[model samples]
Target: MGDVVRAPWDAYFVTGFDTCSEVLRGRNWLAPDFAWQERQDDPERWGAVATQEMTKTLSRLNAPEHTCQRRSLGNLFDRSTIQRLTPVIEEHSARLLDDLAEKLRWGEADFVSTVSEQLPISTIGSWLGVPAADHPHILEITHNQVYAQELLPTKSELATSAEATGHLRAYFTEMVRQRRAKPGNDILTGWIHHWDAREPDRETADEILYRLTMFVTIASLETTATLLSAMVGLLLGEPGRWAWLRENPGHIDAAVDEVLRYDPPIQINTRVAAEDTVLAGVPIAKDSMVHVLYGAANHDPRRTENPDAFDIERRGTHLTFGGGVHYCLGAALARLEARTLLIQLLERFPTLRVTTPPVYASRLVFRRVTSMGVSI
Candidate 1:
């Protein structure tokens, strides 16, 4: 439900909300110690997380603060900005498909690492002014970070994530320093100036580096990669729908929206209530965690007709990218990449077909398929 669709309707309406924390994030939303403030007096774990986000502009937000940051970002991320990126998206998609055609000319290829993963990597990297050469590195780090804290994660996976985080932090710090010394017209450079111009010393250069890199790392890599993989797999499963999209090129946007609704990359989002709240008659205590189930909400029969069906012409926006104060910041860019990639695929491989079941990512907060075998 976008805004309480029906009885037993969602309260927060997306993956980023806090109430259903355990259901979505394996976190205790009602834990007495739950705090978004990141107070210094909190336990060691909370403090550690707080410190980690000191430089993360995207993560360092709560309620009104989050709203304001989102607004500021939105000012630069509207339809106009997305429209500007269309040509670039198309160009990148063309190059990627060219590479894919060469590799799979014999009629078989793993489409995940080769296709789904590449779109977001190059798009996100180019937007942030990073060399295309670094796309693979960013993708690897992002995958490790997201998977490390996943349910039933192995000890080595946890350790690898920690190590990746440490190294990633160090890498971004240098990247930021270099960018600041020589400003550019890229997203990261523009944001660094946006913050510095407001308060010259409020946020240190190191903090700027940490936040932008982390956001770009995940926003451009993990979520987009998942959505791309899922869409490809879903299309391959129903060859009829795939063929329809190929014919009705204008329906690509609707197709992207439907894929998000059916198999959202980030399945759940968490948010904390600052005061006592009642959602669908469930009294939520102050500071209560609420997990907004986008997957559940999207499939709720009350809100949608034939909820599970993949309709390329589905109407209305769902809460897959989130809503209100914390809607996704990278949505515009993600949409552009998807359209470009799909367009190129349809134009080149006249007989695109799936040969194997896709391999899913070992994560619940975000679901991604790392492999999909396709035939031309």
Candidate 2:
């Protein structure tokens, strides 16, 4: 068990792996009640407009409502659906790697821009049926929107994020319109059909659809990019790890899992007490904020042997995608993207080298690499 540490603003932090798991899986704990209201008041608080919009998303909903939306959306991300997209992921990875190789010929390249950032956003944009030409705009909007979640935003930052959010909403609205008129074989089209079948009033259904689309788009892009960047930094940090990966390409899945465990993308998850209750012997009040320190739990020695060591062969799971009803909808997609990129990279450049140390981003909720220089 872990101690309950007090956080700023009278909130509590849950650090034990088992306890955190309990909190995540428990139905009594719920999404923070004031999350949306807080974001609405100060648009720059967490994710600005994006966070404000997500206040209405499935992740923020309770039981029956969450259950319905999750079930309907679940089919879109099932194993078979994700498996069919492998070739698309591979094609994107190969193209990005080809670009990286060309940049390396000029001595060095910024891997974060050339590969880490580009691959995930591009792949996700394609998956969402965003035209290739519109990907850059969407990526810019999502990057600004997602980065705002890292810290309390400045007035200027908040203004910029709010503007980006408007652009995103406009874009999504147009896409939704297009999907409704002429359905396609894309995830968004599937979601639209699902929402339509629900038969809710037009305004209510549209609101739900737009919010859900924004939530999925931002979540998929930001976390996937963060994971890829972190994996690259970790692999290249040690002397033999890169070469080891090249020799043991079969270990890519385990390596990806290990990376998720050692350095998860989203570091903290928050919940609020739905009713007055005791947790791990601690007293609780309704609506009290409880922070689940996923990063800390992942590193907890009691649950993981040699927790600090980055052993790819470690045989266990981490809370990187969270757990229970709120588990990440894109978990499989993320793993597939990472595995595809790593395999393709190792096969293409057997002697990958880090040209410079990686610079990490400073954020409260997410661990990300801002830039890294590398060469083949």
Candidate 3:
């Protein structure tokens, strides 16, 4: 593919590192918000409930609305908050790893289910004050809802996403009511307070808080878990790597960074030309959709030396968390969780080995590792 390749479906795909970065940071590029979707030729595709629901998320909004919605949660992942959550993350990692160790005592344990899936949700769930008991249910709905975020979702997947979105709306709406009635010291309560101060209408404030909460959960859960599983699986797959990490614990940060570059969770990000522009010497019209391939960009030989090989010592950056305004807000938290968990996991199960290859779900945007069998 050239810097920009036109798809058969009439969309543009940006595959080069420089071109992808250019589009992401370009002021003329906009995410596919409600306005953009409305202008599309396919009304049925654009008008789907799942599509409409996505426009309200922080990931899809443009300019002022994106800025305003983002500002409301400015302090959510600040340095102080991450510092405060370190111990909580460690505690959850330790407990989850302990459970994994127990399961390994009998036979092979699925790391994805036993540890990766549990740690991220537990850590984020605790921070948001969502009950531990509801983690499984929330995880299910998020999985279903993510289908709509794929590069090419079928009508069936869209329907599933719509149903999931409805359940999420109802679940979070009630949670918002409960929090308003009996507020706590959690992030959700803090968001409610933030919105209440700005929005005059109580209903409007709650609605804002609902979207914020839902975004936080969906953003933090699956991707981080996939990252955790990928990091562990990659390290264990290479003989002596896990032991080397245990001996050289100082390299945990670098290891995590390399994993992010090698096997990023989100592969592609969608945006529309806000105005007529030329990218890589190619003219693009306004309202044309562009899909920036993050995974491809991360592996571009021009930007990275031996791009396909996984080397923990490499300090190259990755577009896994994206770039520019839509850069992942929970990036620090995700890194913290990964580093904390990896450190403990190496210390506890240095002998852990992958007995079977990891199983990834079929999707173009989000890389979901459904199962990875491991043995001690």
Candidate 4:
């Protein structure tokens, strides 16, 4: 595929690395938010509960609103915050790996369940001060809710995602109420305080607080979990890679980057033209939807040599975390978690081996490893 091509679905696809970068970083492009949704000819398509819930998220908001809402969480995943959370990541990784080790000793253990899915929620839950008991439910609902964000969701998936969204709203709404009644030192409490100071009405502040909590949890959980699973799968997918990583611990950072490039968690983002513009010499009309294929861009041979090969020692950039203002807020935290987990897992289980090929969810947008059995 070239830089830009029009698909039969009435959307422009940008696959080249440079063109994808331009589309992502360009101010003329906008996320298809609530305002954009309303402009569509099909209201029913945009009227799904999942779509409604997503419109309320920070990621779906345009500038001014996006800027103001984003400002609420100042330096959330900054270097200092990541440094502070590194120990938390390590603790969760070690605990999960310990359980995984025991399971592996007996027989094959599903890394996706035993560690990959568990570690992210544990780390983020600890940071948000959510009760440890609630993590499993939260994780389940999060997985359900993400179906709506997929490249194309079926009617059943949308219904399931709607149900999950409802559960998330109820859970977080209650958590917000309890936090207001009784304050704590956790990030959630801090957000309540921060919002209360800005918004005069308590109920409005509480609502914002509730969404923020839900967003933080939903945003941080699944993708990072996928990253963890993907990294481990890539390392163990081939012989000697894990052992090589164990020996060359200094390449952990490079290994993480290569995993992100080779198989990004989120592959595609749809951006609308804020104004009539030309991309890759093709005229795109205003309000037209453009699918920016980050996964394809990452592998564009023009930018990356031998794009199909997974070389940990290669140094390069990728659109995995996205670009511009909407760049992933949890990038640093995700990286820290991956690095910490890799370090601890390698040190703890040198004989760990993949027992079977990884099983992946049949989805386009989010690359999820549903199951991967491993044994010591």
Best by lDDT: 3
lDDT string for model 2 (1-376, tens) is: 3556767765789998988999999988997534424533343364456556656677677777788878877655677877788999999999998898888888889988889888888888888887788877887887676544543556676677678888988988877877888988777877777777795687667777787887888888878888998888788778898898888887899999999999988998888887899887898887777889988999998899889999887866799999988988889889999999989877888778788888876677866677888877
After superposition of all CA atoms, the RMSD between model 1 and the true structure is 5.3
Q: How high is the CA lDDT of each candidate model?
A: 0.66, 0.80, 0.90, 0.89
Q: Which sections of candidate 4 miss by over 4 Å?
A: none
- Model 3, poorest ten-residue lDDT window? 38-47
Off by over 4 Å in 2: 33-50, 147-157
Q: Write the per-residue lDDT of candidate 4 for residues 168-230, one digit (tens) a residue.
A: 999999999987889988888888888989999998888788878899899898899899988
C-alpha lDDT of candidate 3 relative to the true structure: 0.90
Which parts of model 1 have CA positions greater than 4 angstroms off?
Answer: 1-34, 37-57, 63-74, 148-157, 202-205
In terms of lDDT, the poorest run of 10 residues in model 2 is 35-44
Model 2 scores a TM of 0.92
lDDT of 4 at 299: 96
Tens digits of lDDT, candidate 1, 1-376: 3322222322334322232322333322321222453432434434333234432456435545445555445465578878878887888888878778887887788888777888877776777776887777877877776644342345566666666777677777778888888988877777676667755674564575466567656766888888888877777787577777778888888888888888888875555555776655556655544556778777766667888787768774466776544457778778878777877877787688888788886676778787888877
TM-score of each: 0.83, 0.92, 0.98, 0.98
Residue pairs of candidate 4 with colliding backbone atoms: none
Clash number for candidate 1: 18
Candidate 1 achieves a global lDDT of 0.66
Error of 1 at 129 (Å): 1.4
- Writing each residue's lDDT as its tens digit, candidate 3 over 213-272 gives 888899999899999999988998788888888888888999999999899998889999
Per-model clash counts, in order, read: 18, 0, 0, 0
